[model samples]
Target: MSRVSLQNPIASLEQLAETPSRKDGISEQLEDDLRSFGCELIQSAGILLNLPQVAMATAQVLFQRFFYLASLKDFGIIEIGMGALFLSAKVEESFVRMTYLITVYDHLLRRIQQQSTHTPLDAFSQRAYSLKSMVTTSEMQILKRLGFNVHVQLPYGTMINYLRILGLEEHDTVPKKAWNYLNDALRTHVYTNYTMPTIACGAIWLACRDQQVKLPTTPGGEWWLLFDAQPSEFQNVAAHIQRLYHRKLDRQQLLSHLSDTEATLRNS
Candidate 1:
């Protein structure tokens, strides 16, 4: 029996710095870019597939966690991403058919390539059969590598509850803005490093700052303390989330780099 925990354990800065990819000589920039790419795939594909926010968030977290255990040289990002999305849908009880997943991913890849003449993956094609096998295998690999402890405690519900507690749930734009910030934060490493309360608090802080709305701050302590989040910690979380928007990934270059890496791996 797999022991399901309430949430995945958070890693320290040092542990995060020592990812398998880093140890494999992959540059920090490329690793970060890859993570962002994987998250984008999950988010865009989820939106196209009409998956709920929580389900998409779960897939991104799982995808991040899996790469921490397996290096980019060993596992293809698309395969692990597809597996993560497939497994996450099941985990969140928003079950989507495997065929739909395959089609969506194929469409996304073709769209990225801007190939107008591309055809949908035929169900009986060898490529489709191989991809399905890879997705299932990658799913099992992620489960085993993570010790069957794939539970992710997302900040969405916590953010909502915190907003209600802070009397900001009904405030104009605060709730929606905070929720949007939380969604964007999913693309960053903050999800793996910060606690749920801290993330929720950070999103709220960013939203408040954006809307120029004041949160209760007294000499006694900050309002976020009531939710067990420290001022410095949540502030840093907000900063990390903010920096995510400043990045611009070169998709063609990134794909070429990965291709070169795989060629080297195969030839070696």
Candidate 2:
């Protein structure tokens, strides 16, 4: 649920012995933090470029995969984050100019500095020239790590197709919500852990549950069995989406109550 479907998870000792360097990366917690931040940057770039979620999703996957092979110690996380956005635009065929991208990256870095003034870190991070140089290098490194494997599989498209099959293409209920859910999934390691098809099924199921749309397979055995999907895995996917919604609702409620209290004080 929290991961994208992994491919060939089982590793023979021979393979592990051959690739011992992979073990020399950052700590688990550090990797988690960096991956989360990288996704945030990708989301920011998407907003800045007015790109679609597809691009955002692609960029996030690139960021995740790049870090899987290359260590953050070797390359700046932000550089690869932006580079992923740059590379993903091409992969998704929604190319944004490098200058525009640099501008967005600089803006985000400046914001970080304003939030907490650091020393040379802020100085270097805010430079357009430095960003350009590092991102170009990071992009090459990412491509090399991926072995030029720029293609990414996402549940967004598969989910849409499935919704279309269900005749909910224009319903705005399941498909739309599912689309948002798919985007939300990228914020976590969901893409790295779950299979694309399972993610699609889970999103659709969660959307349907929210919309109160009746499922044909409900009140029965694994609803997705007909589609060759594991119901248990899909349940995990649903749970992830549900958690996102619960967290979102909690924030909204907190904000609403805070605003109401402020209003009361203003009137008093």
Candidate 3:
């Protein structure tokens, strides 16, 4: 429980469009790489620290949300992600000691330094920012950037509910695979732009359809129609996630989506 004065009250949807990350201080490609790297680091750190998947998933959303208001150029990936992971643990009621994340982060730095394809940035190793102080400070910045909106609705709950309704809650295997899909979704923009139920529905839908989990024959409607959400957004979520692993195929799928948008624009 922490209270900080709101930097600015959210007034309109347009305000959400004005993310600081779109400020062009960093190239889009570079920003994507850094953001992806930070997200991966959190996953690795979470595993190393024995933190649960929900903590890492929540941390990923906070990481993505914070960068929208702030800037990657202003904050190093290690600091932003570490702070997000720490704060998320608390927010999700899974308290993690700061020492664990900072320590795992240091280990991640060492691994990155050893990797031949990448080099650790100077800021990555700066002694000044490596300390715990940087994480606590970045936590405040995350709150400020988020306008103090820290209550995130994670897909875990909805995923469970959906799986239960489908009679696969305790059946294991596919549901677990779908759960992994939900965790992996944090790297995509769907979490920030779409509702949790939408993303959850997408994950389960993909697991059943693409991943070969059986569905009941009696249900005639589209699987996503079961949830009260924008099915288009769920499709968007599915596309982005499938793109992460099936880049070659989903890249074309992504282009097809863009191509459709262009065609609609032309008709307009």
Could you report the Cα RMSD, in angstroms, for every candidate shown? 3.0, 10.9, 10.6
User: What is the lDDT, from 0 to 100, of the residue 99 in candidate 3?
Assistant: 63
lDDT of 2 by residue, 80-116 (tens): 8878888889888997988788778766765653546
TM-score, prediction 3? 0.76
**After superposing candidate 2, which stretches have Cα over 4 Å from the reference?**
1-30, 115-126, 218-222, 241-268
Query: Higher lDDT: candidate 2 or 3?
Result: 3
Off by over 4 Å in 3: 1-18, 115-130, 170-172, 217-220, 246-268
The worst-scoring run of ten residues by lDDT in candidate 2 lies at 248-257
The window of 10 residues in a row where model 1 has the poorest summed lDDT is 259-268
lDDT per residue as tens, model 3, 1-268: 9875323122246534554655745555556556666787888998898888878888888887777777664677777887899998998888787766666776666555454454433344444244467688888888887876876667788889988877878865768778888877877666777777788888887777765777653366755567775667777888888877853223343233234323432353
Give each model a TM-score.
Answer: 0.92, 0.73, 0.76
Best by lDDT: 1
Model 1 CA deviation exceeding 4 Å by range: 1-4, 218-220, 257-268
lDDT of 1 by residue, 1-268 (tens): 9656676578766668788888998878888888888888889999988999889999999998887788886887777888999999999999988888877877776676667887788887766666677679889999998888878988888889988888888997999999998888888888888889999999999999999999987566878778998989999999988878888887876777556433533353
- TM-score, candidate 2, is 0.73
User: lDDT for model 3, on a 0 to 1 scale?
Assistant: 0.70
- Which prediction has the highest TM-score against the true structure? 1
Q: Is candidate 1 or candidate 2 better by lDDT?
A: 1
From the highest TM-score down, the ranking of the candidates is: 1, 3, 2
Tell me the whole-model lDDT of each prediction, alpha carbons only: 0.83, 0.68, 0.70
